[model samples]
Target: MLALRDGQLYVLAPDGWTRLGGPAPASSTPLNREDAEDWCEREGWDLHLLDQVPQLTA
Candidate 1:
């Protein structure tokens, strides 16, 4: 599922954080980055850039 608060978007899953589909809302919908981050943090999750991960090749 998806959730919006302040101006950010969040993907809810049974496990840890899912993914960020878009930036904070600006027009029709409502989203909050800070709130989302806070929620994730509260849930022991972190928002990180995939690029930060080491590249893998097979």
Candidate 2:
């Protein structure tokens, strides 16, 4: 699963929570699911397919 905390993105990996990259823009706009998936793909991080993970709230 993925989460945005403190303007940064993180992905839950087997080893533990791993940071994906730099901080996100401090704008009102939020990252969508599709974009996050694409990012994980480019970063070579496996995206989990679980629905129990809670959504990230602003």
lDDT of 2 by residue, 1-58 (tens): 5566656676567675666786654553555778767766887766563222334566
* TM-score for each of the candidates: 0.34, 0.40
Cα lDDT, model 1, residue 47: 57
Off by over 4 Å in 1: 1-10, 14-31, 49-58
> Number of the top candidate by lDDT?
2
Error of 2 at 50 (Å): 7.8
Per-residue lDDT tens digits of candidate 1, residues 1-58? Answer: 2554334455555653354766644554443667656665776655552112222234
Compute the lDDT of residue 37 as modeled in candidate 1.
64
Q: Could you tell me the C-alpha RMSD of candidate 2 in Å?
A: 6.7
Instruction: Report clash pairs, candidate 1.
Output: 5-31, 5-32, 6-31, 7-24, 7-25, 7-31, 7-32, 8-31, 8-32
